[model samples]
Structure formats: structure tokens, C-alpha cells
Target chain A: MSLESGLNQNKYLNLSSSWRYLTVENFDKITDEELVKLILENQENFLFLVRRYEEKLTRYIRRISGLDKEDIEDLLQDIFIKVYQNLNDFDTSLKFSSWIYRIAHNHAISNFRKSKARPVTVSMDEETEIARRIASGIDVLKEVDQKLKKKVVIDVLKKMDKNYKEVLILKFLEEKDYNEISDILQKPVGTIGTLINRAKKQFKKIVEKEKIDF
Target chain B: MSDLSKNVLEEIKEHHITPKPKWEFLVRDYVIWAMFGILVLIGSIAFSALIFMITNHDWDIYRNLGQSFWQFLLLSLPYFWIVLVIAFSIFAWYDLKKTRAGYRYTFTKIGLANIGLSILLGTAFFYSGIGMKIENIFADNMPFYRVIHPGRGITVWENPDKGLLVGEVTGFIDDEGFNLRDLKNQDWIVSALNSVWPREVKSNIGMIVRIIGKQTGKDTFQAIEVRPWMVNCDRNGAPAVQPCRSLDRERKPFIPFPLIPMPAK
Candidate 1:
């Protein structure tokens, strides 16, 4: 299996077609925390964590920031570097994935603020999928063609306030639960709930303004 | 390893970057938590002062002050320390929120923690007498504090023009009244022929009492009601409040050190 297809398939744990420092059987048993311990014990093991998170974080950054692939890679490099530097500071209480995601989230937000950029959907399929998932929360996107639905959702998302837009993407596209969203955003869970509610309202208003049912 | 991972490892080597010493992170975590604890303790001290002031305030003398109970209470509360309790709780909440896992707790959770700890430690401090000691220290050292807090007991008594006088009985005057040295050390003839003793107040030398009535002359105050200065009393006039400090509070030195000396009767 090629790396491109692995990413397209959204197989987060598929280490196939990649360099294997640890055997597949051993890697399956070892968790992210255990990987962190191994990384701390020997800095060389940090590569496993880097490889493991590379695609997932790349997609997340590109999805939230709408940065170019090269820019996303550059951001990913910096993020992993930061993760390596701060391994000692990682709280064991949090899932290691959440911790890394939080770091990535904060860095992306900081980067986006410094350079004013709008979030976007990179691919047509991802756009339609996001619109379909988002539509379930509001109203069903009835007989509208898949192409029109994607365009409408993408336009509404682009027009929404950056905060609401980011939250909606995290909830619908990234599939993070409320608690996970709170951790990533470093907001109170209650605040996240309020943000999501307002985001949905804003989304519905934009959809209505567009006035294309389904 | 992926190329980006290789580059990161290479950068790590070039920069000699290491996972910062575990002690550094540990110390950081401890410092944030220590800061939070210190803020809560300071808030508790403010709470203790609040407790001391509210407890020692003459609650039943609102009628003498010519105001309703709530009016007197509203006017007499220690707003300064109450503001401090709120301010320190926010500071404590912010400090706690700075910790790694701190954001997990909402401000309400942290605020409740701060107030609960403050109430617990504050009541303890009040009972341990630190609260009263703090009140006294502020009362004596910071005269400017007098303008801000002015104090309930002292201010209530300071309004002698409104027919209130707090002082020691210096001498007797033929059953018509007594020679009194007021809080300011001024002399006054307190005429108490038909004065009501409302609460275990005795007209004796060196007994600190609060008198209410009219100022009969420049150097005299006609007493309508006499009450003990410090101790709150039930109908029987026994010591009826907890953390009362001293059963002899009325006779002991108050507001300042060592009882004022008057010529023995």
C-alpha cells in the first residue's frame, strides 16, 4: 500500500509501506504513552511518534488553516520539534494524542493569527463529507446535488467567524467530542458547548441566506 | 524514519536540544501550584479579618445609631477586606488556571475551592485570634485605614454628637452622673440618673461602656442607655458570642494597648 492511499483511506495506524524500526506485532501492542517513554529514553524512538502523527496532524493543520501542503509540512516539522523538546513536560493524565493535538492546535491558531488566512476545504470529497455530517446537526440537505451541497457548505464555512468555523470543523470533520474539543481549544467544556451552539446557528443563518435547500 | 523526522532529529543534534531536565518541568508545576496555595492563603487572611470585624461589630446597637438593622449592617461591613477576598480569589483562580491541567477546572470550581479553603482557614484564624490581632494591628498602625474602614465599633462610638459615647468611667458625680474619659481622652460628665442598663454594663471606674443620649453640655453627655462595649449579650447579658476574645473585653484595654489609667475612686 502506498503512503498516499494509506492517508486517503484514513488508516491512522497503518505503518505499511513505511520504514519499520519496530516490528508490526510489537508496534501494535505499544501505546502512544509507551512510545513517549521509549522516545524519552532514547531520542531515536521519537521518530516513531513523529511518523505516527505526521499524516493525522498534517490533515488537521491543512483542514483548520487551509495552508498549502508545503506550509503544512513546515508547520508539522516545527510542531514535532516542539513535541520532542517538551516530552518531559507532557502530563501523563492526558492522552498523549490530545496533548500533541493541543500543541498543534495552539501553534496553528497562533500561526493563523499572525498571517490572516481563511480556513477551507482542500478536496471536493472532503467538502461534501463535511457538509453531509454538518447538515445532520441542522436540517437534512434534501434533494440538492452533491456538488451544490459541497459548494454551499464550503462558502458558509468560509464566511463564518474564524472561531465558529474552527469549532464546527473540529466537531464535524475532525470528529472530536466536546471534551476533546475543550482540551484542544483550552476552553471550559461549557464554553465549547456554547461555541458549538452559536456556530450551528451561524451556519444555519448562512445556509438560509444562500437559500439553497438540500 | 521519515524525512521530516530525520530533519527534526538533525536539528535537535545541531542545536544540542535535549528534553529539558525533568526537574525543570517539575519545578514549574510546583511553582504554579505554590503560587495558587499562597494566593488562597492570602485570601483566607482577608477572610479572617472579615470574620473578626463582623463578629466584633456591635450588632444590636443599630437602634442607638438611629438606623434600621440592615442599614447599619450595610454601612458597617468591612468592604475593604470583602473586596480583597474577591480579588484574591480571582488571582488564585488565574494562578490555578496557569497549571498544565488547571484549565480542566472551570473558574467556578477554582473559585469554590478558593472560597471554601478561605472560609475554613479564616474561621480557624479567627478562633486562633490571628484575625483579631490583624484587625488591631491595622487599627493601630494604619491611620489611613481608619478613613477607609473607620471600623464599626469605633465609628459608632465616635459619633457623640449623635448621642453615643464609648469610654471608661473615671469617677462618680453624686448619683447624678459620672466623670468619664472618652475614647479620645477628653473628659465628660455622664449624667446617668435614669439611664437604662441594657446589657451587663456597670457604671464603675475603668469599665468601658457605650452610652447613648444627648450631649447636655460641652463637657457632659446625658446617658439614656448604657451597654457593654465589646461583648454581645442575650437578655441575661451573659457572653453570648463565640470567639469573644475575652470575657473581660469591656474592662480590658481596647483599640489600643494597656487599659487607660484613671485616678482610683
Candidate 2:
């Protein structure tokens, strides 16, 4: 089917690839680089690309922004629109995921600042994983109560500076490496390591100050 | 399909949002690099001017200035231009950070790179005479700049009591003396009778002549020796009649400046 007709077909989350030259592999199997190339050839292929990142980006935005579901969804809509408009600006040298995450991080931060939403909380589902991840980095003994660790992690994250918290979240929760975090934040890799170290130190300071016995 | 993704696609079709043209991003990237390069060029010009000022200064006159050699050297260094070179290098280094992969380089690395390029290009500028041209432009156009940027001749010729006076011969006051305006804009009556005048130097209306004689009065000077206003005099308060080591060095008490020649009037 022609791409224009597919747009009229109301397929949003599950967009089918209609490019004549692309192999009939499932869209999930195609690298983001190839997908970007296809999208450049035909704008209709953007929907399939968007479907790949929609849920992940939504979760990322929610983790950082603490905005309500509706606000997060609305912000996602704008963010995707921006992505579509700047597809040509995407540098192929960067992993598409890192570039997209960078865009999402910047947009979320600016909107968070403008709306005056000082959101220091991650969403509910990410809480347990975040606690476990941060605790491992800080060497909090496995014997420590999981519930107590979660409380300490959340409280410490909330009190830390936005810069430190953002690096920590990207490093521990998102599982981004130093280079990926550097690309996403537009900082040197060396600086990323320093920031992560400083963030961990801040976490230790907060837990110590509160006398949390983890 | 989730509703949010559906809405985004619907809006994409409704508003027809297309990826911006590749040329636009390319232009933006090139503009950033171009700005970085231009800033470095300007910084080099400032550095070259600094090089010219420092190297062209007559370090030989320290004894006449009644200061130690180190004190004279330190006092004559061009502090204003030094600050400008530093400021421009910083601006250029910051501009480089805006480039696509500029962040990969450390501050010390990038800073040293910018400074190194500036020095290399600045030394070239010093030779091509662009440095002196820029200095003269500032000297002629900006009165305030000229005040802070004392003429090179002013230092060597300021101590009239030490038999040093330099200025433009404004007009002749008959064969015995002439009207003069020194580099500091001070007026003087220059007496050339019983003074030594070089063969090539004429009593021109606007010639910048140097007089090595005692200051006889507040606005009068006796010329023991009169030579062209030159910048590269050697340490004994001597002037080089020409950069080529003029054939007249055999003349008694004659000293020669080297490496630079005064621009012919």
C-alpha cells in the first residue's frame, strides 16, 4: 500500500513498513540507522520509527519530570513532533537512541523549568529498581531491608541538585555508559565520570546526614 | 496503537511536519566552525601586534632611563595588547566548544591548541607588516588609544635632559632653528646650528627627526646630533642610518640600528 493511504488507515502504535526496497524483515530487526535512512526517503516511515521509541521515551520523561500522565503524554507529542522536524540534524555518528534521549532530556528539562515543576521523584514502577541499582553502586549491604533502601534512595534523590540527580539517574537507572551519557548530555566523557562520582558522593552525604543505617 | 502515538501521527499528517532541509543543518554547522576560525584569526592579529611592540622596543636605553635592565624591560612590555590576546584566545576556545565534537577535547588541550595556532600565525603577521599596520591604524584614529599606546619613539627620545629629543619638525625658524612637535604633542624650538645632520635628512616640513641634545628650556632643545626618527637604535643612544648598515658607519660617534629600518618619508 502507498504510504499516504497507510496514514489514512489509522495505524499508529503498530505502523507497517511499506518501503519498496526494504527487506520484509520485521521493523524491530532493522537498525535505527537503516530506519532513519528509510524515513528520510519517505516521511511516512516516521510512524514506525516513533512506535519503536514511544513507550521508552515516555517512561524516561516520566522518570525525570514527575509530570502527571496527561502532561507527560502531551509533552511526548511535542517531543516527537520536534524529532520529526529535526531528523536531518541527527548525526549518524551517534547511536540513534543516545541522540533521541538527548533530545528528550533537553526538552523535559526546559519544560520542567518553565512549568516550575520541581519533580524529584521517579515513577512508581522504577522505584524498586532504582533503589537496588543505586544501593549496589554505594555498596549498601544486601542485608539491608529493601523497603528502607527504597526510602533512602528516593529521599536522597529528591534532595540532590538537579545536575547530580540527572547524571545518577542516567547512569544507574537508564543503564547508560559514560560515552552514551556524555553524548546525551553533550559533555566530555571524562566530565561524565566526574559527575557520576560526585553524584554518588552526594547520595552518601544525604544518607549519612539522615542517619539511614543502610 | 497507544493514543499518544496516534495523536502524534495524526498531527504529523494534519500539520505536514517534514524534517528540516539537510542544507540548513549543514549551514549551521559550517557557520559555527567559521566563527571559531574567524575568532582565532582576530586573536592572532592581537598577538602579532603584541609581538611587534615587544620586539621593536629599544631595550638599549635602559641605562639612560635610570632603571635597571629588568625594570626597563618589564615596564615597556605592552600590557594592553597582552590582555587582548588572552581574551581573544579564550573567546576562540569557547567557540570551538560549540562544534560537533569539540567537547571531546579537554580545556587545556583546546586552549593550548588555540594559543599555539595564534602564535604561529601571529609570528607570520609580524613579518608581513600587518602587525605594524594595525598598530599605526590604532595610533592614528583613536586619540585615547594613542595616549595609552605611547609611540615607540616617545620612550627613546623623552629624556631631553639626557640629550634626547624627538618630534616632527613642524616649520623652520630660519637656518638656526625650527618649529617642532614631539611624540607627546609638546611644542619645541629645535636648534640645529653646530649640530650634526645626516646627508639624506632634509629640512622637510613634516619629517619626524630625533635630536640628541640637551633641553636648553621648557620648549627649546639644542641638537648635538639630528637623525631620522627610527625605532631600532642600538644601546648607546646610537641610530642606524639604514637597515643595510649604511657605508657611513666610518663617521665618528655614529651607531647603527639593525633588523628594522625606518619607513622612508
Give me the candidate number with maximum lDDT: 2
Separate clash counts for every candidate: 2, 1
**What TM-score does the predicted chain A of each candidate obtain versus native chain A?**
0.81, 0.86
- Candidate 1 ranges with C-alpha deviation above 4 Å: A1-21, A24-29, A116-125, A139-148, B59-74, B151-161, B171-179, B184-205, B213-225, B231-265
Candidate 2: tens digits of C-alpha lDDT, residues B11-103:
987887788999999999999989988989999999988987887666666776688999987878787789889999999999999898888
Candidate lDDT values, in order: 0.74, 0.76
The numbered model that scores best in TM-score is 1
User: What DockQ class does candidate 1 belong to?
Assistant: acceptable
Model 1 Cα lDDT, one tens digit per residue, B144-254:
666666554564686788888887767777767777887668989888889886424453455566788889889888898776655442223355443333223333333
Error of 2 at A136 (Å): 1.5
Model 1 per-residue lDDT tens digits across residues A140-161:
3443444446676677777888
Q: How close is candidate 1 to the true structure, as a TM-score?
A: 0.79
